[model samples]
Structure formats: structure tokens, C-alpha cells
Target: MNKQTETLPDQWDAPARFLHWVSAIWVLGLMGLGLAMVNLVKASGLKFDLYQLHKSYGFLFGLVLIVRLTWKFIFHRRKISNRGFLHQAAIINHNLMLLLLLTLIASGYVVTCFSIIPIPIHVFGWNVPSLLSPDMLMEQGAISVHHMIAFALLALVLVHIGAALFHHFILKDKTLIRMLK
Candidate 1:
């Protein structure tokens, strides 16, 4: 009988790949919509509508975050490769990204909750209650923090994409493929 050498897989498990793609798409699309809201719209009905859409998606993204976090702990621990420097950097980046996103969500919640003129989110027929009462000062502060975090997340996202490209094109590793379907 001849013994055959087992080969290592080039990609991640199905659940991890699905989460990665979904998160990437959600972040990219929401960021684009946000940019348009800030730059293109001129304080019109469209701007208001865009804001509502952004908030609704943000709420949805928050739910996805919860599920993803649960999946990370319960099912798939350690996102991708467990190699040397790449793995270390990936762990740091993943943790930081998750923190920033949580902060973004919380700050956004604050902004919405304490809006000058309340713009609450409604699902089905029930309204999403604002935990905090209206306060201009706090709302302004939260808005500033949210904006800063948004910019930081954007930068991190660029780095994430760059790292993937570096892995695929320069390093010629399986890192990028780990997330692909």
C-alpha cells in the first residue's frame, strides 16, 4: 500500500468566506452612500431620504455584527491563516476593525437618539426607542466622534484591501483566496 501526502487547503471555510464578502459589500455600499449624502446632496428631500436609508442599513449592519461576532466565538475562531507575521497583523486588524465598528454604531446611536429633531427608526410598525433623551451638546459630540471613526474605518478598510492585494499579487499567498467564494 502506498501512502499519499495530504495537501493543505487554499481557502477559508464557507461560513468565514460568506461573512467576509457580506461585510465587505455592506461596508463599501454604506460608505459610498454616506459620502454621497455628505458631498452631493444639498439639504433637500433626497438628502433626508438618504439619511434614513443610511440609518436603516446601519441598524441592519449592527445585527449582522452581532451574528458575526457570535459565529466567530461559537463556530469559526481565528478568521484566516495562522501563519507568522500575516496572522499577527490580521488578528490586530480584525480586532481593531471590530472595535471601530462598534464605536461607530454606538456613536451613531447617540446621534440619532439625541437628535435636535428626532429621526427614529421604525421596523414594521414598532419604533426603535431612543435610550437617551434629546440633547444638542451630546448629539454634536457624538456626531464628531462618529465622523472621526468613519474616517478611521475608511482608512483601515483601504489597508485591508491593500493587504489582500499584496497577498494575492506580491506575496502570492492564499490569504486573499481564503475569503473568496
Candidate 2:
């Protein structure tokens, strides 16, 4: 087999699977919290608290993603069987997911950096200062981009889950089983 299509094993490494699950949990949690904060909360204090919590956890999530990507680079992940078009589609979907996530992180950072008000970003109690000066216009633009990316990510995640289920139930392949292991 060529390097691009070379099959390594039937299962992903434990660490990569762990990181994958972690990212899923964090992404879902943050999205729910964000929606609740915007739509449900009425008290300014409560809204502010939720925003801070969201930002802090998001900052931490970014670090987790960085570690996951680094680990991916340092290790050889098990490849899905080369099933032609389906295989290429899976690869494209996975890569696009990664790109969207990274873009989300960068846009989130930009939002905080250009906020009209100073937004303190803390990760596990350590404060992270803004990297850009306050600019309401830039902050608004970033906020819009962030929201758009979030919805796209959510849709992509659902598709990923659906594809996994389809593989497990219809294809009768080890595709889903490999990730689970």
C-alpha cells in the first residue's frame, strides 16, 4: 500500500480516542452553556458569570486541542480502511472538522481581545491578558464569525456521529468499533 493509504491497525491509540471524546464533551458543553447564557439568563451578574466560565473553559479546551494535535503529529493513528470515495469523504470530513475547530478558537480569542469592555480570560485560575486593544467594530465582527463557526461545527459534529452510527449499524464494519476501542 502507498503511504497515504497504508493501514496501520484496526483501532485508534487509546490517547487519541481519549482526546477525541474530551473534545466532544467540551464542545457540546460549551455550546449548551453559550446558548443558555444568551437566551435563558436575565440577570446581568449571572450572564457575566456564565460568559466568564465559558471563556475560561474554552481557553482550556484550546490547550487540550493543541495537545491532541501534537500527539497526533508525534504518533501514527490507525487509518480507516481504504474504501475509495467513502474513505476520501471521511478524510475530508475529519480534516475539515479540525480546521473549523481551530478557526473557532482563533475567532473566540479575537472576540475577547477586541471586546469594548475588558474581558478577562482565565484558564484554571491563571489569568490570560488580551492580546489586542479594544475595538468594538472588530469585536462585533469576530462575534458574528464565532457564532457562524459554532453552528457549522455543531452540524459537522452531528454528521460525524451519524456517520459513525451508520458504519456500526449498516456497514457492519469495524470502523466505529475501532474508535470505541
Candidate 3:
């Protein structure tokens, strides 16, 4: 009997690929949730409940982003290999997107941590006490930064998606398929 030596393509390892899709999904979901939360805030009703749910999603996003980063560092897959100048620019743009995602998640959690709601939750079994009251000026500042980061993340994601589609349809390259697989 001949043994088949089937390995994942050289572009990305299994774990890295999994993280890529997982993070992408989570980021999209978070974007929707963030938009909903902002709308709820404007209505001045369900504000508390919406804020709590937003914080919960933010915490999850932070955890997933950290895991994805760790997996990337560990696996160290080959970078996307395309010859065109735009392809090279895509690589740089992708890195910036990752950085923006990380910033969004980190700043989101920090804003939640300083929130005044006093929701009791444990991070990795370590109790995180609320650092600031809801009306605190510092908490307000954190919230402002968090909203800015969220917008930046959304913009980056849009650019990333557009570039991927360009590569898929226009360039007709395997770059997108490499990650999809």
C-alpha cells in the first residue's frame, strides 16, 4: 500500500489558516455589534444592556486576537508571494490591517475595564475590578479612543476585502485561495 504524503499547501499551516478565518469572522461580527451599540447609545434606551453586550464581544475579540497573533508567531508561514507591485502593497496593507485589528481589540478591552458598570467577570480566572466609574472623565476618554480604533479597524477591513477580491478576480491568482484553503 502506498502512503499518500498529503500536506497542507506551503502558504499557510492548518492552525494559521484556522486562526485567519476565525479572526475574520469574529472581526466582522464585532463590527456589526459595534455599529448596533452606537445606534443604541444614540437612542438613549437599552444603553446599559447594549453596552454590556458590546463589552462582552470586545473581550472575546481581544482573546481571539491574542490567540491569532500567538499562532502566527509560532507557525510563521510563508508570506503571500505575488510578483506585481500591487501584490507587494497588499502584503504591507495586510500587516497594517492586523495591527489595526489588534489595536481595536486592545483599546476596546481597556475601555471596558475602566467602565463604571461594575460587571463582575474574571479574566483567566483573575478578577478584574472596574477601574473607573461610568461618569469618570478618564473612562470617557478611553471610550473616545475605543470608538476611533473601531472606525479605523472597519476601514482597514474594507480595504483588505477589496484587495483580496481584486486579486481573486482581476489577477486570477491563487493568493486568496491559499488562505481560503
- lDDT to native, each model: 0.82, 0.87, 0.72
Ranking by lDDT: 2, 1, 3
Clashing pairs in 2: none
Determine the backbone clash count of candidate 1: 0
Regions more than 4 Å wrong, model 3: 1-11, 40-46, 77-84, 120-127, 130-135
Off by over 4 Å in 2: 1-5, 77-81
Q: Residues 20-80, candidate 3: write the lDDT tens digits.
A: 8888887788778778777746655576667666666667777787888777766574443
Better of 1 and 2 by TM-score: 2
lDDT of 2 by residue, 17-88 (tens): 899999999999999998999889999999999999999888889999899888886675554457687778
Error of 2 at 51 (Å): 0.5
Q: Clashes in model 3: which pairs?
A: 116-134
Q: Name the best candidate (by lDDT).
A: 2
| Model 3 / residue 159 / CA error / Å | 0.9
Worst 10 residues of 3 by lDDT: 1-10
Clashes of each: 0, 0, 1
Residue range 1-181, candidate 1, lDDT tens digits? 2144334467777877788789889978888998899899997999999988888888788888888888887886433334577767867888889899888878887889999797897555656789999999989999899989999999888888899999899989777777784
Predict model 3's lDDT versus the native.
Answer: 0.72
Clashing pairs in 1: none
